[model samples]
Target chain A: MTSTNHTLFEDYLRGYISDEEKKRLELVLDSSETEREEFDLYKTMRRTLSPNIGNPYKERELKEHLEELGKKYTHEFSNEVMEMPVVRKAGYVRRILSVAASFTLVGLIGIAAMIPKNTSKALAQAYVYSSDSTAPSRSVNGDNLITSSEEYYLSGMQAFKEHKYETAIISTRKAKVGASPELIQEIEWLMALSELGLGNDAKAKELLTEISTDTKSDFSGEAKELLEDLNGIMHRISSFF
Target chain B: MPTAKTYLNGIKQTSHKVQHPDQKYIEALRTNDMILVEDIYKNYGQMITDLVKKNNGNAQDAMDLFQEVLIILHRYSQEGFTLTCSLKSFLYTLCKRRWINELKKKGRAETLKVADISDLNFAEESKESVEGTEMYDQRFRFCKEKFNLLSPGCKEIIQLSWRKQEDGKYCSWKEIAEELDMSYAYIRKKASQCKARLIELARKDPGFKNL
Candidate 1:
């Protein structure tokens, strides 16, 4: 079908066309089975893609709800699988491996304690978003609408607020790619906060440095203050060593 | 013979059987009923996790596939699709097919260790439902893929144009044009051209013929 007819058919399907236009479109569609088929496809697409009718936001919520349920079930499933006799029976080699694993875990805990921790996390607890934080507003301006990046960024922020720091970091990193400069700043700020939430103080400090040094960044002022606080926390922690 | 309307509506029906008892699952999905949804996981979730785990996948993969399948089912349910077969058979078949396709996409098709499902012997009605849902899922994915490829401006315009206002009316092109700081004619033409491009892309796809 011609592009004109395609648009007309869409308009008719969307109820954007007048009765005359609808009649004209129907006459054109009546000319061939192919036309009708193409029109039907458009109709299907409309039915499927129409935001109000399809209620994509609700679909997303449902998907998230399902993901949570899936996670819970799979966690239980994994536990059940682990409890099976075949998996549970330990041989001599397995017993030895377990002993070594215990020693390794103890050594790792000692090393982790020696490393400065919790200070950054404490600092981040203040900087990171809470349930009281306002939700990200929808981008109304067409020029600013990078839908995927916006979606990822929003999800990242949501994860951050929920204390899913690892998920927040992953999502924010994805949002960083191909994002606008302004969005990149927001993403970087969130990433730094997520790193701090994860207790990766060095990574958080590095991200904060980048944002603070960028004069044009919206988060520069806050990042700079957080960097100073982070430094003081590190300084106090290092004094113990 | 099923015409375009039948295809547009849903899968062709061979029988007017009573709706399966498990139709509640579909309804639960549509309404986002948490109790029934959890029951879905309680009853059949293990089967999917086991299926994925045995086929070089982890619990996470199973979880992702499970969510995708639920979303697809929910979309079809919204389209008034009826459940003639048991939801278990339908979900199992759909997950198996989707996992295989996912494996292919990941270049692990050769490593797909899923046992031959033919022996399970899905009835004709279940097979039909699974196929129809898969087709609908594919078409939805295709449309989204094309929609994402549109210019950022076009995407925003199309999104805003189709989105309903608080009062339950689609935002007029003129309102969208003003919001986007563009002339009405330019906005209208852009929206039309954007939709045409999407349709044209779908039409040009060789796979669309079978769909």
Candidate 2:
């Protein structure tokens, strides 16, 4: 190709050329196999240089996420298997009833029996926790009411596990209202996930930003992971569409 | 006798029905569905581990290979890739092939025992898909490295030109030039020159020829 043709090719690839110039360049490429080959290479290089394709930083983050998930599952799978039979048997009754009349009684029983003794342990096994410290367990009210902040937190976790995220958000927000400062961070982290589950990405992101900015927050590691995960998911969803 | 038009239409129809069962897995990977990913590990992790171990590899190698395959699938899914067979079979084929390639690279190909993989038919399209992903990844790394090597001014100009807003429109060169306090023609020429330099640097690598 001539020097002029090469410059035109570069200009065309950079999208700086006029329509007429593009047409002229295409005509030249269409007439010569060698020119066409060079044009193809230029086109491929342009695409490869684009920030959207095969981003190494995003790829690294995803790899780390997958590795963490693998490790967590490997450690938890055995325990989950042992617990599965018991959960299945007890969970059957909860699945069968849908009536409002017995709802409160069932919820109490579910919280009593369904909420495992080490509920936090189960949550830790199943999900990445932002904080290393566990929330102190408060006694459940026998009157089937959420009285203590701890009960409210547990209720939110239970609803979250059941994928009832909106309810989880409400209960978890209530837990945050009068909780000790230590527990407030944990509540905010769970509330972020609840917001994510409800497809309230902006709200979830806001919560994550708050958690991540608090240097002393025990949930910083988890908050960072969720924040990156949220960004990755949003980017992928946008790209897919 | 069928006409040429009918024959071409038949080919198109056959291509349309080549949907594979692993599409859901691909979608799950793209969406970063942890539950499905964990399930995949549960279902196929042992098989991959055994396959790697039986072929002079270890559990760690198996894990690495599995993650690499998933990463490749994730990358390809972004480019509108489709599966043409069961995910299990496709994954097994990819993992096995990659393991063999690794062995070859390490000069252990002579000692490699060919496992019986008659049941796993690696389709032509699947092979192309794997190769294409590898090529794209190779080129992407090369371009990224070269772009990073450019002067700071060049890098800044090139990046600004590629920056797209949330509305999917690129930031105009006029705006970029104004922000940078440079002439519009200079910015455009500089971006093109930086890109050309990147392409030139990438081409200097022998691996680029193969890609």
Models 1 onward score TM values of 0.55, 0.51
Candidate number of the best TM-score: 1
Which docking category, incorrect, acceptable, medium or high, applies to candidate 2? incorrect
lDDT of 1 by residue, A99-211 (tens): 99999999877866887554655667677644133245546124664578878998988877777665677688778777877778778888888878765565578789999
Lowest summed lDDT over 10 consecutive residues: which window, candidate 1 chain A?
A78-87
lDDT of each: 0.71, 0.62
- Candidate 1 stretches with Cα past 4 Å from truth are A1-7, A15-18, A32-38, A51-55, A81-241, B1-18, B102-125, B164-169, B178-183
Q: Per-candidate interface C-alpha RMSD?
A: 7.2, 12.8
Predicted candidate 1 versus true structure: per-residue lDDT over B93-149, tens digit per residue = 788888988878766667555554341554344887888787777877777777778
The alpha-carbon deviation from the true structure for residue A12 of candidate 2, after best TM-score superposition, in angstroms, is: 5.1
Which stretches of candidate 2 lie above 4 Å from their native place?
A: A1-18, A31-35, A49-57, A73-241, B1-17, B31-36, B110-114, B117-128, B135-156, B175-183, B205-209
lDDT (Cα, tens digit) per residue for candidate 2, span B1-211: 3322232233134245366776888778766777787778877776666566456554456677888888877765654566776676667667877898997886665545444434234433366555555666676676667777889887787677666566656677798899899998787677667666766776687766664
Model 2 Cα shift for residue B93 (angstroms): 1.5
